[model samples]
Target: MQKTRPILAWETLLDIARTDAPAPLRERVEHALRRAIDDGHLVPGSALPPSRTLAENLGVSRWVITEAYGQLVAEGVLDARAGSVTRVAAPTLSERMPPPHPPSDHPAPTATPVDARFDLRPGLPDLRATPRARWGSAVKAALSSIADRDLAAAHPGGYAPARQAVSDYLGRSRHVATTADRVVITHGASDGMSILARELRRQGHRAILVEDPSWPRLRDIAQTHGLRTIPIPVDDDGIDVEALAAASVRTGARVALLTPAHQFPVGAALSPARREQVIAWAHAVDGLIIEDDYDAEFRYDRRPIAALQRLAPDRVALIGSLSKSVSPALGLGWMVLPHGLNPEHSPAMPSLIDQAALAHFLVRGDLERHLRAARSRFRRRRAALLDALRAELPDASISGIAAGMHLLLELPAGADAAELARRGRDHGLALTPLRRYEDVSRRPEALVLGYGNLDDTLVSAATAALATLLRARSETPVASVRSERTLTG
Candidate 1:
């Protein structure tokens, strides 16, 4: 006796097919059907509509439907016995394997705590403020204006118009001296640093000088490329050029990495004297300086210091990115290469479409207008966080607030910053201890509080929670605190 077949719901399949896909029409149909089956919208023993019927429904050629069905059948995702209606096949042997479990001693990794109330992790912008409508308009303008030939292949350095836009923006804003010809677009500052590190290694440089308590990632990048990193202490006047020079002499290291505009983790502008000293040191050693202009766009105290590259363009390689001023997710950055120092290998570039869109955005003056509004918003958020912190913990030393999204908070002596950070996680407040960025022996008993992502409304509550924890720590008996530290350390 023949049995009735279960009819598949064509609406689900039709919706999936109509959605945008990056592949050919036939491949899109195949992927859509597979997704429907995997998602349980189409179960095993369900019969698909005939190719002619589905093609008519989808407004595609019958050949497309047939090809999709044929491919799925070949892959064992669909069953099409000569005269039988096509149906989802049983789970393949490869798909039947059980999920692997972690070792009993090691637990599976977890994401950000579900209970997190405030995120204070630094190096993030206010994602809520992204200019979606303006960006969409820029993208549309870019698509309409771009030549067809420009899309066929991208220049390794960057899309020409995008590079020009960046060059002009830098000149006007940061006072960086460079032309589009010398600009190399990159995925972001990290990618630009990696490229420079590799090129430095290739150029027979064995050692590189880095700030002692700098962003750990920069040192890691140099070390990864086989360059020994000599730690140079950074004081209130930015990187210690005298110490850096001494280190260079001792180690024969000729390359240095600096965040001259506003130092990371610790905000200190390179003083006029130190700037001269650094440039002189570079000239004396015939060395190179890699300047990371990470957050030079949002200075509140006064006009931002001019790019160090502008002082001696031939001696410095300046790297800047949109991560701080704009959203990091854009993954767009530029490197103003020193004259006669182009890398043999080009660093990875961002999407050509993104490059075109940015060019349009810049040319239309949308970026400048957006930044004016962002500065006002971030300024208010920063002030709120600072006011809350001051009210909660008057004795705690807070600095590095002159610019950038984060500030350095130095707790009173004997406070365990690491322990506070750990406890913060439990209390639904995410915190980062200064120790995370420094060497193990260097303990500043400080925390880097990022106010960028923290909502203005949560400032008072989050600060109060942090103060309560600190007060609790202060109340513990000295002996008990030492014992706890000994056990944890």
Candidate 2:
């Protein structure tokens, strides 16, 4: 059964959010973390997020979150004053042991440090800046409007109002037309992929064709469910379609996932013509295309491009979420399947089964309204973040500044991205390393700095620190005299 993949937004605190989130958000995320800890989802005494890194990951300026972490420290929930490391306090929840999270059969929970800065970690967006009041109002409205009976068990596909909102949001915002009935709301894009993986596997689907430097997690999720992933290299125009076709034929992998618009870290947009060719390939091979729209909302240079889902809704599974546009902590994202998909089944349609828990949640949920509010707030915050990036990184020569919460800097070769991140963290600053996303062993040196969560002041500080770091590096022996051979080539 295919579960509609909803997206997950992981932020530590919303309690002290000066602007982005509210107490409930903070409480919920923190509560989840606490439960995960006590329940073993997060190991006991696992390295907790350095408040500063938590701030960066959530799109909040670091100081506010730093203070919040101090509170947790004071409350004995976390260890404070642990420079550069945020360690979870020993579990104090023994009073009434909470229910254990069912052990995941997939024992692989990727061990990601909550405090990783200069993250450049793929599949995430700066989400600490979404407008709280707006979302609160939406949630209130959705809840008030719900019928007592509506809260009873319903379709696992998703709730109608939220599904309609998503369908509308995609159609209007992304130029992809679809009815709410076709939308499946899972926990996040990850959940959607799992469902897709499961369904395809059940029907004998064996392999997935993917971009070589594509999101590692997608392949992880795919392989977790027994699908062989084929690597297809990407160039400036997005995935090498010809290469993908060749790989598909060579490997007999019929399903392929793509980030055509703002293709992951390199920020390549698939040309319109190439998108058409991809559609043709899918149709010709009876294959499926998973269009992962990782970051389409914050293009700075020009208008946002329409989604590939628009060109061929029947063949493309459009994956979108508010993580980048707003806050990942909200855990709101959606999957739009082609009208060809099932249980709306037909030969032309691909039938998908829904998960039971997801079905139960929607029957009694207010998620749809929250998504609407989140999208609206995120759009506004994205603009603000962009302005901050431009003002702060004046000397860095930022490109792909067109959209998204983050931008890239073309740094000198051999620049140590991890070192730069470390130095930033040492001084109350946080950032993502370009090496985290690219083929570090081979890709050019760069940095993926985020502007979404921080206010102008912090953004400026981060940039200023970055400038100093780069300057110091330039003055160093290694940078001042690059091997003549390194430059000649």
Candidate 3:
């Protein structure tokens, strides 16, 4: 038994039609009435007011109302009885329309929160120190100097001046043995690695040696290019070069990817002996090395180590980016390739505006100035973090603090790193479990804590919170139980 819908009165119809008119009054009225019937706004078998009365109520002429009603009648949209009463006709399409979908009881899950208040995310540079004014000036200068030909279609490789600027910068900073022609600009270090992997695959190489417990994304890039990754273990003195050689020989891997200068989260500069041995292995196997010179500029303890590419120019491709030194948002990186090795695979180049701006930035020595100031600032932050960590976790053996923005803290044997990370999150802190970097079970349980971006107050607070959680959960040796009560209270 269906309940009857009330008749749509003339005033109600006029009220519905009073929405902003699309254009002329005639077209507006006609379309509005027809739409109302079609959409069941004026329901089937409902009475419509007489034209004269409807027009009078709507403030439109009677002819307008009559014309609209006559049009609907001709279209079989309305039924006009002999008594001169117009009623809405039964809807043909509306009757066949699908029912509205019911709303779901469960909504989509929200994205994971990235902005942890005490975020200690490793590998993130101090973005707050980016020289914005200098960058803007460089961009302006670059725009003013950009030639008409630069706006025309250029090679997908990259702008020559930008590439040259990068080449000169690398030669001066990393001591990479290369020229402007050999430098290929990329969006960033990751993109540069991907491009190199693709080229290696093109050359029929299937396997490449990677440092175990290295940046996971580096292995991902190689694997994504269809290359099998052979994990070479990394020790306190950087990658074990002998193990690397043995693994490469066994796996028939002709390419090795390494971070020789300030080895990632571990912060080990490859021992001179191991660096020489790895280069020898590359020569022995006719292999090539890809040196990721990421974060070489932020060395705190002593003079920065020279790049491995400097020693083996013909057998190494050095990749570096401004992301770590300047800011990650500046997506600019370069690869200084070995001579005679043509990376013919063209990558989609970055914006000409960005390229030109970076070129000007490099040439103007703004990068050096910023790095000088940033190094001092980072050094202070690094010292603060170390002091706090020492004060909090006396028994913990923290390594990799000699260089880079992060340090690896080795927890007590049998302690749960993953669980500690979970507890850290409970206190609004973010921790990177060391196990995440290794695909194998060689490395011990540890946490890679980055003090790069956080200020002194943030560093102290975050470390203190982490220390409290660790003390509550584990019996790991801490500096003193006295600070624990202070932190918790």
Candidate 4:
């Protein structure tokens, strides 16, 4: 009797080939085959189907299969004799090493549940709404128009055209008074912050002031670059300029980072008097202010506030990115440095192609058009969430709804925002407690509800679920409520 060969499933390879991935046919086939082997779906000595057979199954030409198999054989992932069936290669020394395991006392980690029906986490836009066709066209146009020398190397600041485009857009839209010479393109706001932090440290700055409940990533970046962070309190009028000035004097810090247009997590724009005070403080201390102009494009109630940089361009280093107005996946941002500061030796810059594409996108006015549409969509979503929250939790304090993508929801006293958030996750709702953004110990009594990425259909349901959690907490015994530090919202 003849020995029977094991049959491997071809459906996985077929599915991969049929997907819309941009890789070439041969590369895709090689990737699929390599994955199968690494996953142990095709064990050592397992026979692979003939090239002709797999080609027919995957609806690709035989050459693609042959090329992929030859490459795998060269990589030692497979073995093939002159006329014999190709088989998965035996495990090499590195591959034979035992898989890493957690400590005996610790349990193995499991993947986080991501099937949440509603995701209200802040700092994300509707990724599904990305204008793929327009971006592709922009990229194509950029590729065709860019000179050969421009591709050879990128300027440390940025391509001239990209810088000019960004400068023009900021001047017109955000009222940032800057020229292309002052613009330095960065990977994103985080990258810009990192660069600024390093520069501040180099300028003999030992400490920097930040908003108490501001975005934590920027503070972390400053700390990483050897600057001690001094937390300054923020109120309805935005960062307490008095506290900032006192801290700067006490710490001898000459740099302060702020989110003035729309404060993070709390959504307070800097009051006009406070803005002037901040600029005066910068001048009095001869300090620099790093303005984080994030998510200021989608203001709903009225026209967007002019950028704080406009007031004192000489003292403020304005950083803005496409993360909110567009998708963060693009990894594009810009910094308008004060006259004396230069980012020639700053950290990594964005890709040349991406910068060119953005220039084209801006020149064609696609960015403004996109922002207009995004504002309309976000307005509707924000209104829906506000209406739902108002109707369900009338006693709860809601603020920061005047602008930005997220609003602060302060749960009534005795209700645990953290506990409510945990319960929310179990019911397919995502919640972020306000304490997550604070460096100091604070009560977890507030949640930041981000409606930018939430779907229209799920707004009502998400709010209802949150209300149920809050109601349940309220019904619990007073003895169950634990004392915690005070939180600012």
Q: How well does each candidate superpose onto the true structure, as a TM-score?
A: 0.79, 0.64, 0.76, 0.79
Candidate lDDT (C-alpha), each: 0.82, 0.62, 0.80, 0.83
Q: Which clashing pairs does model 4 show?
A: none
Model 2 C-alpha lDDT per residue in residues 314-424, reported as the tens digit of each score: 888987765565556656667889865653211211111212222222343333454445445445654554455446433344444344555566566557877776666
Kindly list the per-residue Cα lDDT of model 4 for residues 304-373, writing each as its tens digit.
8899899998999999999988899899999999998874445457778899999999999999988999
State the lDDT of candidate 3 residue by residue for 1-489, as single tens digits: 113653755655544345564566666777778777666678777778888888887788998888888888888878786755688876678666865753666764533236778878788887777899999999999889989887886755688899899888888887878888888889888988888898899899998898888898888999999999998888778898888878877889989999988777666778888889989998998999999997888777776767899999999998888888888888988888897677764547878888999999999999999998988888888778878887878667777736678888776666678888877777887888888888774676788888777766788888889888877875645432222110000
Q: Could you give candidate 1's per-residue lDDT for residues 1-489 as a string of tens digits?
A: 125656666556455445564678988888788778877899777788889999998889999999999999888888888777888777866677766765576786644453478878888888788888888998999889889988888587999999999999989988999999999888888888889999998899999999868889878988999999888887677888888998899999999999988787776778889999999999999999999997888877677778999989999999888888888878888899998797964544787889899898888888888888877887888888878876877556776737778888877778888788878887788888888777532836789888888877888999989888888887742222111010000
What total of clashing residue pairs does each candidate reach?
Answer: 0, 30, 1, 0
lDDT (0-100) at residue 112 of candidate 3?
21
Among the numbered candidates, top lDDT falls to 4
Return whichever of 1 and 3 wins on lDDT: 1
Collision count of model 3: 1
The predicted structure with the larger lDDT, 3 or 4, is: 4
- Among all windows of 10 consecutive residues in model 1, the one with the lowest summed lDDT is 480-489
Q: How much is the lDDT of residue 216 in candidate 1?
A: 91
Instruction: Show model 3 residue runs off by greater than 4 Å.
Output: 1-112, 475-489
